[model samples]
Target chain A: MAISGGAKGILIFAALALLALALAGFITGAIGAAFVDKFSGDENVVHGWTGDVLPLDQPAVHLAPQYVFGDHAGDSLDYDNKEAKKYDDSSKIFNDNSFVITNTILSSLVTSGVLIFLFVLGTARMSVVPGRLQGLLESLVEGLLGFIESVMGAGKGRGVFPLIATIFLFVAFNAWLALIPIYQSFGVIEDGHLKATFLRPAGTDLNMPLALALISFFFVEILGIRAHGIGYFGEFFRFGNLLRGRILTGLIDVFVGLLEGISHLVRVVSFTFRLFGNMTAGEILLLVSSFLVAFLFSVPFYGLELLVGLIQAVIFAGLTVVFAAIAVAPHEAEEH
Target chain B: MADLGFHWPSLLVFLVNFGILLAVLYYFGYKRILAMLDQRSASIRDSLSEADRVRQESTQAREELEAQLGEARRAGQQVLEEARQAAERYREEEQARARAEAEDFLRRARTQIEQERNQAIEQVREHFADLAITAAERVIDRSLDRDAHRDLIERALSESAEAQRN
Candidate 1:
């Protein structure tokens, strides 16, 4: 019997979601394996910022399908000293770990390379009347620039377009790249363990997301400073103003200022996790769906992932714009 | 949880990569396009403004032309009216001149006719007297003296004049 469109759509969605779940589970495994050492060593190999290490003889939570992680289990047993079992429980965060290359660095370089290639291709022969590729690039850039201007009035918005535009495009492309079937699936099997996913989503890693977030954060703060001299901090630290002014209003000002400062700091974390969580979740959903069903059945979920990827990028870029606008005009914000 | 791992090498690489991307996109792509777009917009605005100015000037020129046309028409009508009045005055002056000349000519002709008529009357009367005297001379045939006859003739003349007067 011929399947209805609805059934096909459902199958596709199910395939994508299952693929995301499976890939997400694999990311967990891969991270788990990163912590596990192949041979015994007296000094604990500092894997990342987290100093905590688990003896990998046995894993606490073996993620969804057990087979993909089975290779690591065998490797750990072969070397008895370093038990190869540790599963990540903490979500993505960025902290200073003395520079050691990770999969994220490789993925990021690849993503940037692709972006650079596209930029060169798009801007190769710039013309007033754009061709197809140029037109598409312009539309995306102009469309995004218009959105930023809308959020932050046209006059003030122009200065911050580079940061917001770059972040949006980079994050969006990274997210979309993750959706490709071979992105997380294709890897070299070394001693029964999958090694080196050739092209991973940069946003999926904590480093890239955090790095992007920091860029946005600093850009917003610096813009604020540049716009409103050193006095810009007066918006945050109102204790002196409180002492000099009416008690009630001053107290309110102080409290509001502190809250604003806290919110400003919180944005870094917010920006980081927002991109990280969104891309990671989409990656997981896609990975799980692909693992669960055929590629043909993952079409609907692929569409959904595309939409999610776009939304995440927009949201990330949008927040940065809003924050920047607010930072520039703090007095206006407080009045409201 | 696997995502929380921060590798500095990766982060540094990411920062540099993105930084390069921003510079490229900003300089080569976004900035260039924006400049072009701005130029296009400025050109459009200039064209629109130029068109507006030309339209305003044309409108003013048309109004001026209409005013001049109306003034010229009024001047033409005035000239025509002046010509008609001048023609009427000239005709009247010529008629008055002709009438005066005709009256003088008529008066002179009437005087001449009166003079001729008076002359003719005197001639006829003198001739009649001559004829009567002659006839009387033939009838009398020297029977009376010259002085006596002359007296008689005078008497006859007086009598005749009396008869004629009566």
Candidate 2:
């Protein structure tokens, strides 16, 4: 009976993989024809994969001035151009960045929602011998915990594991899910152009990265404050206690402290750009690859992006854990 | 990257999304799952340690039982040996006492037999003397008394007893 359990485990895994493969094939079959039929147009309609390029701002339809007075195709084309121009002018007058929600924000919401759903379902019934969802989540949790413990001591790792792991899963899922042939390929046709893609990978957005950076930045600083009280400020503005000490040594200490503070502050920018740039570049690379060499050659690049996506998540989470450890460690504590 | 420039609305949306994610994940899933994992691992470890301790205790008890069995065997042998030795000593003492009593009885019987034999011989010698007297008296028609023969027999008996003593 015990031996049967082992065999059953293998059989289950193989069956699940086969089922997934079959589902993917079925989806590609259903959607591939429609995509080809729609996009297989003349060369003028540039199959912009990234959708970053705005195709030539051409008229949606023919219009004429006479069309306003009488219903006619020629007259409509003449009048439509003026109407379009007037709409553009008014839009320009009131347009502000405040209301301009990027595709990344929507992607981010989708990413978070998916993660929450999976996590909730996975952990709903946690048997000691886990089910499928629990098994997957356990592996992820254990792996992140191991990484955290390896960087920080086991005691300190527990404190920051949740935050780092959350960031990692959110970022990584967005990156990989963004590549699943859905984010950019499908969108509503607007004004004779495929504008306003409904989904974008969260990491592709600068704002998402900035938000993540701010989160990490605040966490690190908070940890420092908790660990050392007001003394953590010494790492930054060391000159506060300056002239009341050893003169030459104090000046060097203050200057070094200032440099350290600057470096610490710059980490927010570094974090933001690093993750945002990597994920965005990865998407662009995949899009370009797909365009250059249809499906066959594109497969390898997809695989490459998968690896890259994983690496980015690991780097992001790993750095967060390490930084938290460094921030929380007391100055007098010897380095492990 | 047409809209790659800064967007204030995007920032707020991202922050809001992240905030919701943090709350949902921490409250609904991660907290419980992590606690369960910790509890399970600790339970497993405790069970393993308990099993090890039980094994150790059983092994120790078995060894003690073996040692006690060996001691019991040795003590049993010692008791058996003591019993055999006591039986042997009792048999030897009984045999020696029996032999001494038998020798004393034999000596007393010999003394009584010698005295009886001497007495019988004296009676036979007196009877023979009386028979001779009677035969002579019958032939000559006279009676004779042989009491002097008894004295002779008594003297011989005393000498024989002194010889036996020497």
lDDT, candidate 2, equals 0.69
Least accurate 10 contiguous residues by lDDT in model 2 chain A: A61-70
lDDT of 2 by residue, B30-130 (tens): 78778878988999999999999999999999999999999999999999999999999999999999998999899889989999999988866766565
TM-score of each: 0.65, 0.68
lDDT of 2 by residue, A1-336 (tens): 356888999999999986775544333331332353444354444333322243322122111011111112122112224455532211121222223333565578788989999999999888888898898988888888888998898756777878898889888898888878866665445447554355667776677888889898899999989988998887777675467777887887789888888888899999988988888777677655554333544678888888888888888888888888888877866223
Clashes of 1: 25
* Residue ranges of candidate 2 with Cα displaced over 4 Å: A1-43, A46-101, A191-193, A240-242, A245-254, A332-336, B1-3, B63-86, B93-166
Instruction: Specify the CAPRI tier of model 2.
Output: incorrect
Q: Model 1 off-target regions past 4 Å?
A: A1-107, A117-136, A180-196, A241-258, B1-3, B67-75, B78-86, B97-166
Best by TM-score: 2
User: Where is the poorest 10-residue window by lDDT in model 1 chain A?
Assistant: A58-67
